[model samples]
Target: MIAEGVKAPAFSLPDASGRMISLSDCIGQKVLVIFYPGDDTPVCTAQLCDYRNNVLEFTRRGIAVLGISGDSVESHRLFAEKHELPFTLLSDSDKRVAKAFDALGFLGMSQRAYVLVDETGVVLLAYSDFLPVTYQPMKDLLARIDAAS
Candidate 1:
């Protein structure tokens, strides 16, 4: 995983609508970038829904949530629409972005991980779990972001 306090690598990946979104575009807001394994899977679904449920709180704090996976944009679109996820779901079909963040595992799948990036693009927290069924709790993630701020 990328270390906290290191500069986040720049990236521009396609969103569900096929529009490119770059880290630089989020320079003025705290960003929570989540790298998950795939779309429609049980653990991944639950993890994303957790974030979706708390999206209002994140927005209130000016934090932007982004979900990245190797899934295609179409899959992302369907998943986001089905779950009513308000965040941007970026398509990393080639795993380039995941590899850059060190979230890609030996199986060529992204580990369940997240990086909390400050407004200035410095990583505030970097966390990942190799176990697909395990994910960091939403409250814990929020606390870290709060402490960082």
Candidate 2:
């Protein structure tokens, strides 16, 4: 996983709507970028569902989440609609964005993790691992945001 306090490279990955969303689009706001191995998988589902369940908290803290994977936009559309996810899911079909973030093409897919970036694109917190199925890091980030707010 990439270390904290480093600059997160900018990206313009396509969303389910085929719209390009870049890291700069989230300027002046904190962004939570969660990278998962794949969509419609067991652990990935739990990871996304947990974030989906905590969308309110994320919003109340003035943060936004973007889930990225190698899946196509159509796949992400189905998953997001089916699960009612509150955040945008970015499609990195070519794995370019994931590779730029050093979160993809490992183990034949993107690895599961989260990167919390400040308005300046500096990573405040980063987590990389597929075994953990909890949202502790997300919670921790919320706590920091709450304390700062």
Candidate 3:
């Protein structure tokens, strides 16, 4: 897992709309990247819904929430549409971004992890949820930023 205070790797991956979603674009803003193994699975679905439900709260704190998976762009598109995800869902077909962030393992699947980056792209919080039972842990990320401020 990535440690706190490390500079996250820069990335430019395609979103559901094929737009290049670059980490640099989000550098000056708070960013929350959620890495999941696949789309439409029960745990993944619940995890995403957790983010969706608390998305307004995150935005209220000036945070951008992004979901990344090795799933194809089409899968992301359907998942986002089906869930009405208000934020971006990044596509990592070849897991390039996954490898860079060390969010993957030798099993060839994106792990269930969360990374919080400050305005400078330095990681302030990191967690890997083996079984995410709730979304409230994300609030801890916001708390960390507030404490830093």
Candidate 4:
């Protein structure tokens, strides 16, 4: 994982709608970059749904939540729509971005992880679970963000 206090690596990926989203686009805002294993798996679904359910907490803190996976844009679109996820779901089909953040797992899958980037683009937190079933709750992430601030 990228170390805290380091500048976040820049990345441009397609969102569910196929629009390119870049880390530079959020230069002046805090962003929670969530790296997940896949789109519709049981754990991935639960993990994303947790964030989707509490999306207001992030928005209220002026934070943007971005979910990324190795899934294609079409897959991301279907997953987000099916889950009613309000946050942006990004496609990292090449796993380049995932590797940069150390979220790449065995077999080129994206490891379930979270990277918190501050308004200045510095990493505040970098965490990844060894197992796909584990995930950090939105509240815990919010707490980390609050404490970091």
Candidate 5:
């Protein structure tokens, strides 16, 4: 996994709308990058929905949330629409971004992971959970954001 305090690897990927989004575009804001295995799966859906439900809190703090997975743009669109997710879901179909973040596991799927990066592109937090049902909770992410500030 990428370590805290390191510069985050830059990436440009397609969002649900098929528009390209680059990490550089968020250079002046805190970014929460979530790397999950797939879309529409039970745990992935629940985790993203939880983030969606708390999006306001993140917005209030000037933080941007992004979800990345190996799924295609079409799949991302369907999943985001179904869940009503307010944040961007980027398609990493080649798993290149996942590899950059060291999120890919032995199974060739991204292990559930998160990288909280500050405005300058420095990583503030790096966490991953191998088990599908478990994830880094929103409250913990909030606490880390507060601490980072």
Candidate 6:
């Protein structure tokens, strides 16, 4: 995992709509980068849906949530639309971003991970859950972000 207090690696990936979103674009705000194994899968779906449901909490705190996976933009579009995900669903088709964040697992699978980057792109928190079923809660994440600030 990337270490806190270190500058995050720069990245640019496609979103569900195929628009390019770069880490630089969120430079002035806190961003929660969520890395998951795949789209529409059981645990991944649940994890994203939970975030979707509480997205307002994140937005209220001026935080942006971005979900990344190896899935294609088409798959990301379908999944986000089906689940009504309010946040951006980024497509890291090559798994480059996942590898950069140390969120890549065996066989090139994306692991469940979360990286919190502050306004200046310094990592505030970096966590990876090897157990696919486990996910960090929004409340806890918010608390950590608040405390980090």
Clash counts for all predictions: 0, 0, 0, 0, 0, 0
Minimal lDDT window, size 10, model 4 = 136-145
Clashing pairs in 6: none
- lDDT per residue for candidate 5 within 36-144, as digits (tens), equals 9899898898888888988998999998999999999999999999999999999999999999999998899988998889999999988788576787678986886
lDDT values, one for every candidate: 0.91, 0.80, 0.82, 0.90, 0.91, 0.90
Candidate 6 local lDDT, 1-149, one digit each (tens): 88889999999999999999999999999999999999999889888888888888898889999999999999999999999999999999899999898889887988898898999999998888758788777787678778876
Question: For residues 7-110, what per-residue lDDT tens digits would candidate 2 score against the true structure?
Answer: 99888988988999999999999998888877788778877887777788888767889999999999999999988887999998888877777776436587
Question: Which predicted model would earn the best lDDT?
Answer: 1
lDDT of 1: 0.91
lDDT of model 5 at residue 57?
89
Higher-lDDT candidate among 2 and 5?
5
The residue ranges of model 2 lying beyond 4 angstroms of the native Cα positions read: 130-149
Instruction: Judge candidate 6 at residue 75 and give its lDDT.
Output: 99
Which scores better on TM-score, 3 or 4?
Answer: 4
Tens digits of per-residue lDDT for model 4, 111-142: 88889899999998888877778887777778
Backbone clash tally (model 1): 0
Candidate 4 TM-score, C-alpha based: 0.95
TM-scores for all predictions: 0.95, 0.86, 0.88, 0.95, 0.95, 0.95
TM-score of 1: 0.95
Which stretches of model 4 miss by more than 4 angstroms? none
